[model samples]
Target: MNLHTWVAARGGIAHREDAREWGYSPSRVRAAIRAGEVQRIRAKWIATSEAPPELRAAAAASGRLTCVSLARRRRWWIPEGASSTVHLQVGGNAHRHSSQAVLHWSDPLVDLGPRSLTTSIEDALAHLARCFRFEEAMMIWESAITRESLDIESLRSVQWRDESSRALARSVRGRSDSGLETVFVVRLRGFGVPIRQQVRLAGHDVDAVIGSHLVIQIDGFAHHSTAADRGRDVAHDAELRMRGYTVLRFTYAQIMHDWDGVERTVSSAVARGLHLPPTERRR
Candidate 1:
């Protein structure tokens, strides 16, 4: 195939022969950059695909497109973006790119498990945690799991420097839930609080179990609050308690905004109830 065909199909080309095969000399490649037929991918590369409008925006605006946006483009999973960070694959030794972007050059691309760009699943989920809010990360992480984004190889391929990050990546792939449930689970995980997602207990499917001690209920406050709702919740809590489960209730607002407090409460309760030494906790 011609150089342009090859580049467009490939998205990135750095070699000189590939440029020459496009019926253009090296000077012509430089001239085209000056003429604007193609945009240089940084100082040393080119996007042969003509950079789709969004990709161009992602490339130029942030120099890295990560988390939900990358997932959306690559894996087709849409996620909320509350000032989420975009990530690029600059090697650990690469100089920091200046673009108001929250760059993660240290975390090399491993294998997003056959994702849109073939980045590693650990890499993808790590990017999610680094760039987006806990809520957004949770949603995408859970969605990715439900959709099989977290293959064993991809999770194993995660690259991180800190022990916490490495640990989080190891376990992130197995948790999956609805969009809101995802938010709850992610925040819980972020704080290093143990949680079991989508567990069946007390004739109700609890959203999460914190260290096998407490059940976190992500109740929709909008629909709840009626007398019947309170009655149901109380009954559920009693049933769960009878079966050795502590019920920690959180509304949507509590889950989204003050998850730290929620985590503190749950983690403390878990530590006390499960007899886990405080330091043995993973967070």
Candidate 2:
């Protein structure tokens, strides 16, 4: 591939050495730079104009993207109302380069070369454990586990540097089908009721089942948007109800924007023994 295509293919930025390794000579790189096909950052990095702003910012700051910034790039589920601050990992002795960026000074979980513009998944999760609250961190961790097909046992084996990280490694079951489900499970853990996720009932997997009968279905922003999808969900709910399941359906807005109301509704259901089996409830 040509220089511009190659650079753009690599997320619109690349190390000069990587370009050379890809068979572009120094003169050719210089020519590309002069022709405005690529721009050099510091002396070692070159970027096309279409490079993501967060990556370009990291290159400019001589740091690697980490924490929520990298999580967002990797499409991990970030909690609603989480900070949008650009998070970067820099050397401990590095001076403040940008007031807008939140700098992480911890040593990386893995060694990254100077040319690397982003932290490894391990390092990003380690940083996230420290940067976000426990529930928020768990959301991203569970999303990463599901998206990456990460082995939970292997994650537990890593020598995580913080108690939060270790706790998360222990707590994460990698069972959440989506970040929304993770949020629901983590937040409801305090209720002391047994909750099973992705339970197969009525030939469909419900989001969660509390006790033996109460079923929880969480709808993401795009979930059930289509009429057909909504119809299928309605039919499934009806089938579940006919089978003696108490179905509690929640939307993204109800779960994220108005969690208090959601919590109240759930707590009310549990308080009235709605989560119990019919025979147990009668007792």
Candidate 3:
């Protein structure tokens, strides 16, 4: 294979040993770097200029992508407030230098050898469980399953290394459409409010329903962006209101950046008896 194909096949980066295994001489690799066809990551790794930033970072760290970095690359929903650190998984015995990146030293379930720039989906989820808080970890886990990046059956059989990891595994329901929805669910769980997720009401599937008469909508950018979609959503909210249900809508920004405001709004609605069933409201 040519340099472009070789680099592309290996996630836009390759090690000197990989090129050597493919019969590329050291001089040829050096020539490619000089000719601007590829850039040297360090003494041993080389990458095409078109390689993604995460891959380049992994190459610089002499590590493979894992945890949140891998999750973001695979388009899984990353929870709000998740650290921006570049997460990498190195060997348990590997000597690592100090850097701004977060390094994990656990053995992988499926080894990607030393030069691979990305982690397997299973390994990513495992690392995510160990790295993040329970709610944030479950959000990512469910989102991965929802996106079909990892299969539910495979998740069931994977061996978890700790109680927290096992608990995260058991909590995977694969239902939340976005990280915002995951936050919505977890935040409401503490209120002792009986919530029905993905419930059909007034010809629309809402994000959640609290108690009996409160319909909550979470507007992620993808699902509710167009003008006509917004109009339709407003109409649905009106219809639900006409049906005697109190409707509350929260955007991705509101839930992520101004959570105190969001929680206060919900709490006030519940305090006003808006979330209760008609019989409870009357009583």
Best by TM-score: 2
lDDT of 2 by residue, 240-271 (tens): 88878899999998988899999999999998
TM-score of each: 0.49, 0.92, 0.81
Which candidate do you rate higher for TM-score, 2 or 3?
A: 2
Cα distance off (Å), candidate 2, residue 175: 1.5
Clashes of each: 6, 0, 0
Instruction: Return model 1's CA RMSD, one decimal.
Output: 8.9
After superposition, the stretches of candidate 2 with alpha carbons farther than 4 Å from their true spots are 92-95
Model 1 lDDT, residue 136, Cα: 60
Tens digit per residue, CA lDDT, model 1, 110-207: 53321122245556567667665545655666667777645655665655655544655555555555666766665555556566788887687877
Candidates in order have lDDT scores of 0.59, 0.89, 0.82
Considering TM-score, which of the candidate structures 1 and 2 is the better prediction for this target? 2
- RMSD (Cα, Å) for all candidates, in order, is 8.9, 2.0, 3.2
- Per residue, candidate 3 scores C-alpha lDDT tens digits across 201-274 of 87789888988998889887565467987788889989998888999988878887899999999999998899
Greater lDDT among 1 and 3 belongs to: 3
Candidate 3 Cα deviation (angstroms), residue 107: 0.4
